[model samples]
Target: MSLSVARRTVTTPILLGLLLVAFALLALVVGSKPFNQTIIDIFLKVIFVVGLWVFIGNSGVISFGHTAFACLGGYIAAWTTIKPMLKGTAMPGLPDWLMGMEIPFWASAVLAAGWAALWALIFGAVLMRLSGIAASIATFAMLAMVNSIYSNWESVTAATSSVVGIPIVRSIWPYLIAALIAVFAAWAYGISRHGLALRAARDEPTAAAASGIDIPRARLIAFVISGAIMGMGGALYAHSIGIVTPDTFYLGLAFITLSMLVVGGMGSLSGAVLGVLILSSLIQILRWLEAGIEIGTTTFALPGGVQEIALGAVMILILMFRPAGIMGNRDLSLPRGAASDSQGQTGPKT
Candidate 1:
């Protein structure tokens, strides 16, 4: 790579990492417990949305099922981290070996990534064969199937009831580290040969195939990587709230994360991070309004459900005016005048 190209590669992740660090510091400075928790939530959303961007953005396929991987990861946290006695009472169906095992929160997150990736590979082997809407529908079916199984498998999953006793991680540092890991991982994949191939296939499938690209293989690689990222996110999410439930990682999460990606510009990594930050800030403000913000002498408050409506309206507005997202297809980079190669190229499009 040229000098400018190498610099750009390193620059994107650094800038994104700094943004996350800034948010963490802001939360610390505020020193409010609720605000700190909100920052942690934002970091988790960054992980989830960025994971989705890795596959959906590069492959040009919308997946309604990535949250299923999160669901898997969340339950893995419950199985591995809860105390043995608690596990026995809540999930009597767990095998003796599993019920007796308990690991730290971080270890569970690692295992969750692997477990989710294993399932992603299995499912992707069959689902990756199809493309476009067929692939999208198949993924949604995967989500529904996973949800149904988790919701009714009383022996292992505790059915629809919440699984408690997860180790709550209130510290913002671990979340910050995980979010940085996710952001760097996504950036590395984007600039890698496989990611380039996948994007090529996405933009011109016929041409890519004609040039001997294994389109399905490219997509499957993205699927597995994205799955692992989402899995880790889910595990951290469980720790953040100290609870796990089938419904927590169901359609609601899927839609919100997907919406963040879509609103940020599905094709841009910067968009994924920005989408989470912007929407999360809006959500927090709405929550404050709902709780009755004091304006001078009077208390002003929006209705309870206005947050959801506002989110929907903001998404609609973004789609109508900036369909490519705030960042469009371009990444956050140094100014065009800052650096250039002999051919006047700065770096790859992403």
Candidate 2:
């Protein structure tokens, strides 16, 4: 890359990091305990959305299966971090080694991520062979299979019942750090040769293959990387709520995360982060309104579930006007010139 391009590349991630830290600090200062929880939720969502972007944004493949990785990660945390007595009783079928082990949360998170990535590699090896809608369907099927197994595995997973006793980390600093790590990781991959090649294939597969890019390998790499991220997010999410269940990482979450990614602009890292922050802020506001917030002693309240309806309508309107997303694949860049693009300029360049 040229010096200017390289500088832009480095500066983009730095700007994003600063933005996230600023938000973290703002929440710490201004938010009460409940509000802080909301902030933590947003940070976790940031990780999940960015994880999705790593593959879907670059490879142009939509995956409904990523949540399986999250479910795996959450269970890993449950198996590794929960008290041995509770784990043994709740999941008696677990092997002695797994049933007896109770490690620190951080270590379990790492192991969870590694476990998720392993499965991603195995599944991606097979699923990455297919393309377009076939790949999408295969991924959805994989998700269904995982959900079925987790939901029915009563001995180990406790079936659909909630597993409790996860160590809660309510502090925002750890979550903030994880969110920053995810952003940097995504930025690093996006500018890597593999990421570039993958995007090229996404736009023009035949040309990229003609140029000797191994599309399947590139997709698999992205898939594994994204799975690791989703796994980490899941582990943190389990700790955040102090519980785990199959439904926690199922279709409802998949739709919500995918919507945030799509509504923000799936083609860019900024979109991934911004989508979560923006949509999360809207949801928090709606929740407050639903709880009857008072302004000048006149309480205002929205009906239950109006938040989802309103959010859906807003997403529809945004897609209608800006189908590409609010950012539309543009990187967050510092202003350097009066004009950046000349596609629709009516007069001569300044």
Candidate 3:
């Protein structure tokens, strides 16, 4: 890597890390329990969005199926971490080994991520063969298949019923660490040779192939890496809420995550993280308004569900005004007089 690139690799994450820590501390000190949970939710969203950035941003392939990995991870965490007695009572059909074993939440999370990545590797091996809309459709199909199975396989997944008794983790520290780990991992990958090669394929597939870039292989690697992160986030999510349901990782989540990525500038890691932060902050603010604000003799409140409406309108406006997103595919870095690199027409500007 060039010196500038090396500096960015170190500085970019430091900058984003400071931002995340600042907000985390602010939420801890200034917010109530519910508000703190909101912060945790935002941190998890960061993990999810950054995971999406690793694959979608780098490979230039929109994946509608990543949430399936999250679903898998969430259930795995639930299955492995919940008390053995509870598991036996709640999911009697589980294999004897699974029903008899329970591990700490952290270990379960790691296992969950591993399981999810294994599936990603298996699925990506097949799905990565196609490109453009074909690839996207295949991924969506994969998502539908997973969702349908999870929604109906009552024996293991509890089907549409929410699986309860997954330990609730109300602390912010674990989520903070997970989010930072995801950010740094993304940064490391974005600057790696494989990440650069994948972006090259994304921008100019024919030229990239001519130059001997293994497009599908590079994409599969990214897919697996991103899937691991998504799995971690999903595991964390289940712990946060103390429940796992098939619908929890379905279209609504997919839409919200994709919107954050698209609105933040899908081509940049900074955009991915910032997009979640900015949009989540907006949603929180609108929700607060919906809850009602008082001024002297009057109480003001937005109509119910107005937060979603306003958020959608705001996203549309932002897209209209700045199509590349708030960050516009640029890496976050300190200004170096006469030494800075130009933002290029590619994802992960390494």
TM-score of each: 0.95, 0.94, 0.96
Give the per-residue lDDT digits (tens) of candidate 2, residues 52-137: 99999999899988999999999999999999999888999999999889888888879988999999999999999999999999
The alpha-carbon deviation from the true structure for residue 146 of candidate 2, after best TM-score superposition, in angstroms, is 0.8
Q: Compared with the true structure, what per-residue lDDT tens digits does model 3 show for residues 209-319?
A: 999999999999999999999999999999999998999999988889999998898878889989999999999999889999999899999899898888889789888
On lDDT, the leading prediction is 1
C-alpha lDDT of all candidate models, in order: 0.90, 0.88, 0.88
The whole-model C-alpha lDDT of candidate 1 against the native structure comes to 0.90
At residue 179, candidate 3 shows an lDDT of 96
lDDT of 2 at 283: 96
Q: What is the C-alpha RMSD of each candidate to the true structure, in Å?
A: 2.7, 3.6, 2.0
Stretches of candidate 1 above 4 Å error? 1-6, 336-350
| Model 2 ranges with Cα > 4 A deviation | 1-4, 338-350
